[model samples]
Target: MEYRKKNSITGVLRGATFSGLLLCMAALLAGCSKDPAAGPEGGVVTVSFAAPAIGQETAVQIASAASQAQNGQSPATRAALAENTTVRVVAFTAATGNPVQANYVAEQTYYMSGGKLVPCTVDDNGSFVAVAPDAKMELERGSYDFYAITPALPLGSDKATVSVAHKVDYAASATKGVTVDASKTYTLTQLDRKCVRVTFVIKKSANFTELTALSVTPSGAGLSMPNLPAAQSVKMGADIPAAAGSETLTVPASAFTNTDATTATAATVLLPRSAADILLTCDLTYTTATGSSRQTSFSSTAKNLALEKGKHYTFTLTIYPFDVSFTVKAEFETTISDWTDVPAPAYPYVSEGRYIVSRDALGSSDQPLHPDWTAATMPAHNEVSAYNALSSEFEVAAEDCNSADASGVTPNPGNYQYTWANALPACAAYTQAGTSAGQWRLPTIKELETIYAKKDGLTGVGSFTSYYYWSATELSGASYGAWAVDFAHGNTDGNGKSSHNYVRCVRDI
Candidate 1:
């Protein structure tokens, strides 16, 4: 009996020791199990397992159901384990980074029926309301993603992640046919796409300063620009999606020709009358299945396109000049009539054209104005409406001038009342005075000052000659010689009255 008792004690001790060893092994396993990483930068993912409780006597029926069947297996327990053991993923993203045409955008980012990530086109600013709580989707037992492509996304919260929860029971066997049946019953509904509207018509003349001038700022459909002067050759570009698909470029009023024509050989500015020489350019854009954008620039070559003002075009004018500046007149002196004549002023024996009508007719400063003026039929500005107006008054005599009214010395003349109101309206009126025999008058001192451009040397624009072209009227003092423009080095010589000089005609609007 003593020997038997000692054997029993030894057996009990062995059992206890085995139990301690098992506990140690379990602790080590729990501490050392490998786990997966989860975050925006996704990598391998993992979860831990919970072992079954020991020495717990559950009720007969409940225990049988909860506990493993033969060889650690049960239907209910097996299902629960299977549900916890594996997970499926859902994916999301923005199809397009374009905002609705409003100050702000309110969007609802959600999964659609049949597992689609569909987005509604937004046109106004505000939150999306009246959306259902649940949505239908079709997804296999794997991974998925969701997101918005609209403008608000950048200002919105970071990407949201939903990890799948799963379990598996070692004590309960699982069947091969086990499934989660995630049947099109997921929801990302009412995901607000809040936004503000920014609706505006294209500025009549786009101020380079006002435009955002960014790469993705869309100007028109199928077009994008940096709101700046475009360069000739572009480097490899980065892509940005927009709301529009196409774009049009418009020049104010009318720049290029509207009919078929050809460009001149070496002319920088081509105003084609019957030939094609004008050009317009535009940018290109690409759309994604989810509505993204990528810009590719292109140039346009056409004979004529009727371009109206205020219309918006995708391509901006980056490198171009539109028109020629106004021509300026110069001054000179002569020795014909003494400037002291007051009672009755008389014209010289002959007259010349300010600029030898044909540039080839010109010569040195001391040379004769024109070889033919001495013998040709040269008329006085007094015969032309423009000069007559300056000589006579605010209004000239229709017989020799353009109008019957007379100024003699007020309003447009030496009068104290010279207003931009009168001049500006008259200038604008000239636009409609085509072929009215003659239109536009010689500018008085103040008016002419605008075009009296002078520089260090007569390098370009004006004729590089030192000669006089007579003004219609006499100087402020009758004894003073009538004013004349000198073209050589921009100046005015008003000392020679009877001196023979050039004449140019003008009219009133």
Candidate 2:
């Protein structure tokens, strides 16, 4: 005889006649078989399972219950459930009708397809079709208990030991006693998923630029739930490693707003329900603008968290910059008021003045001041003295002073006791306003030594090469020589006037 197939088997059973209602009631009432429905020859029982009727209200209750179970507090608002992907069904038979402790009957898994439960089918060639909807299983007629779970269980040993592969698995089960009644179909509902839904919302401070990685691990007791049958306790052995099993989630850029309003959200994690509190430890790694890497960790333990089945918990974490420490060099005051006891005092010489030494050696204007100390051309003794008659405040050419041409290929020397004093005013970088036009000159040996003494304070502000710098002082008896200061060791020595050395112009204001 043909049997009538109905849509939404769960909804139909909810409004069936009193006799049909008894059969429906038998689904959840384990072992209660009063007057079994008679079946055709061979007594074959047909059973079908469907997805739970998860409405917005039911979704909210599930989320609320989950939050209260995993954390001592419940969310102010309810949350929506994620999409259902697959379903699993298991059958058990016992003379006493207690499915939880009865003998294993049969088991099959199905996946969601076109909004229906389809059993996984295998082809003749040994290839398996992973999903097929409305899968029905025929079993020998008897009073048998049935259980159905969602997101189908992973393939493993047997009903006594089943493993869940997903990071977050939503599991629901319904136990019903079915008696074959001329090809009867039973729809399963009110399955309690034995897991908690957890969503993590991570945020970073302004000082942090990129979030390299984030990891969450549940530590301490309560990692496993007692709701599972004792015979199937071995399934808990498949628990994900605490430190490992970090979700491969990408935190979107929009989640990093300055107002701490932006957040990177992780997909829901299906954690096993527990009777005790579970502590979650989270680690964050990030980068900074200065090319520095930093790490921080947070630990939150909900006191007395009795994780109930089918609940949801949300966690919001805000990461701040780590405290950093550094040292700054002290600087000497830049003012100097005395120029007394000097030889060959000139007309524009003032008793009191302020002087500034060039922080960098002359170099090509296109080069960076800090590290690029090499320049194309440098003036020597003869070129500096040739301009002595013109004006003390002469702009010195960038080429070698001893060279006859601007190309610096031909060497030429003038009077042996040459002074860069006349050429120093040309270095506009070191010259100050309201001072004698030619006052900007090469520093004396003593003045160069003073600058060397305060080198530490000028570290970042000035770029000084560890070479010799030209000084205004001439070697007392050496006609062709002048004194130069070694910036490397702060030593003064006499060198040929025509010899090329670095120049750091100085000016008094």
- Which has the greatest TM-score? 2
| Deviation of model 1 at 162, angstroms | 26
RMSD list, candidates in order: 29.1, 27.2
Runs in model 2 deviating more than 4 A are 1-42, 54-84, 94-97, 100-102, 121-129, 132-136, 154-161, 164-166, 204-262, 268-308, 320-509
Each model's TM-score?
Answer: 0.22, 0.36
Model 2 lDDT, full chain set: 0.43
Model 1 misplaced stretches (Cα beyond 4 Å) = 1-452, 455-462, 471-482, 486-499, 503-509
Question: Per-residue lDDT for 224 in model 2?
Answer: 26
Tens-digit per-residue lDDT, 156-262, candidate 2: 44464454433444455555566545554566654444444444555554444444333332221122222322212323113322222333332233333233333
